[model samples]
Target: MTTMLGVLLRVYLVLGFALEVQTFVRLYVLSTPIAALTPSLSDPALDNVPAFRRLYAVYCISLGLLRLAAAVDIKNKGLLAALAIVHVVEAAFSIAEVLVFQHVPPQALLDEPHLKTTGFLALLVAQALLFAYGYMTASTIKSKMHEW
Candidate 1:
């Protein structure tokens, strides 16, 4: 079971890294085209904020690197725990964005593509599952260490 969990975690990490890198490229390198394609995804207030976009790109790339490292060394309990925390924090921020901050207007929500909303919900669930898996993997590793 532990081995299976580790394998799943590794796969998730690699996929996460790929996604982060893709987001970084889209946000930083292809911002204009991407924004044109998905105007609803872009906030008009942030249009003039190039620095914010660049900072976000940097953040995405950093997360990608961390995910890559975690995937390479799945047995590292500390890394697993750190990743778990990251996932939870991200999830919390996302929740706060939509719920607390009202980042997405209620009336405008109906005008957006259903696929986009579904995809965001799917990502949220995946983040939660990843957090659980990371915690389980780290706990398993700690137990095994004591068994030796």
Candidate 2:
């Protein structure tokens, strides 16, 4: 008898894990071609740095693993809370990178040929929504309770 929140959280966690793993693969294994194809979407300073790309890939994979763990143990409140916080941080960093850090101009974000920036921003928004949903779901879980 899993609640709707539990089901949603599980789905979100699984999706997040898949996306993170995909990001790791793209960033590490296909960095060169991706960078060449989308120079404007890449960071010029770290684009050619293999070490940085690998480090980022590791980070992405680690996050994916965390999401996978949380998805498996969906009744763990602590893990859900941590994942919510992680999602918040990820969304915040992405927003900062685009707005505060000026990685991409605010006005030019949606002006790209293929809507890359638009997709990036939309993903961030989705992550933010996931964070809220995760937090709510976590709060609904009781300590020492295993079943959702």
Candidate 3:
């Protein structure tokens, strides 16, 4: 179980690093306007650019650090705990955006892309499961440190 959990942590680490790089390129190097991106492609919570940037920074930092720690201490309880906390926050924010802004926005402001409600709901459920998995893995490692 510990080995499996460690593998999962590494996977999360890769995802975190990829997201950080992509966001950095989009926001800084590319100088791409966030609004120009398809609204449906990103979480509507990102509608507020400043807030989104701040939250994204937090996500990137926590994920990068935690993943690196996991690599060093494969069964590190502290790293798992930190990662669980961050994932929970991200999952919540993503879900909230879907719920609060699922509808199409005004055409005058930004053209709303078509959304597959079922697909969106499925994605939300998947995110929730991922968060739960992170929480469980962290707690399990803490409780059964030797086994892991």
Candidate 4:
């Protein structure tokens, strides 16, 4: 049976993909005015750094692929541990960004309280599960051994 963490990891990656699409559209297609793309996609900074935005999108996609790799190789405890840590860190970074940096304007969050709150809740859950499941999973795999 698949673990809940596995399922949620997949969903989170796909969501990351969707978010990348939005960021790409805003930066490339919609021509949303800003420099750096905000974590929430609500506002762009005053910098016109397409390269940074493009690379960030690539980072998201690559992390998704890495998660898939970790999932496929269950015996590789290192990969699983790394995967979990990376995911948790990603979620934490997102939450921190929301707290420390500029997020969607207050009016916007107020306008769609349910949607915003749900998104925030999902991030919190993702962060919790990553740590809870990551090391526990690593413990299940044995390290190298020599048979003589």
Best by TM-score: 1
Consecutive 10-residue window with the lowest summed lDDT within model 1: 33-42
TM-score of each: 0.73, 0.72, 0.56, 0.55
Please state every model's RMSD to the true fold in angstroms.
4.5, 3.9, 6.2, 6.7
Q: After superposition, how far is residue 136 of candidate 1 from its true place, in Å?
A: 3.0
lDDT of 3 by residue, 1-148 (tens): 7556656656666676666666655755564555443233355445557766655555555566666666556455566556556656655654455456655443322223434433444454564465456556665655655532
Cα-based lDDT for every prediction: 0.68, 0.69, 0.55, 0.54
Q: Give the higher-lDDT candidate: 1 or 4.
A: 1
Better of 1 and 3 by lDDT: 1
Error of 1 at 41 (Å): 6.1
Runs of candidate 1 with Cα error greater than 4 angstroms are: 32-42, 103-115, 139-148
Any idea what lDDT model 3 has? 0.55
lDDT of 4: 0.54
lDDT by residue (40-134, candidate 1, tens digit) is 33345664788877876887899899889978877776777777777677666655555445466545545655346535645766876766677
**Residue 80 lDDT (model 3):** 56
Candidate 4 clash total? 2
Model 2, 1-148: lDDT tens digits are: 3366677777888998998888887777767544443233356777767786777688789989988998888876667677777767866766676666655566776685536756766776776676666656565644423564
The list of candidate 3 runs beyond 4 A from truth reads 35-55, 102-148
Instruction: Give the range of the ten consecutive residues with the poorest summed lDDT in model 4.
Output: 139-148
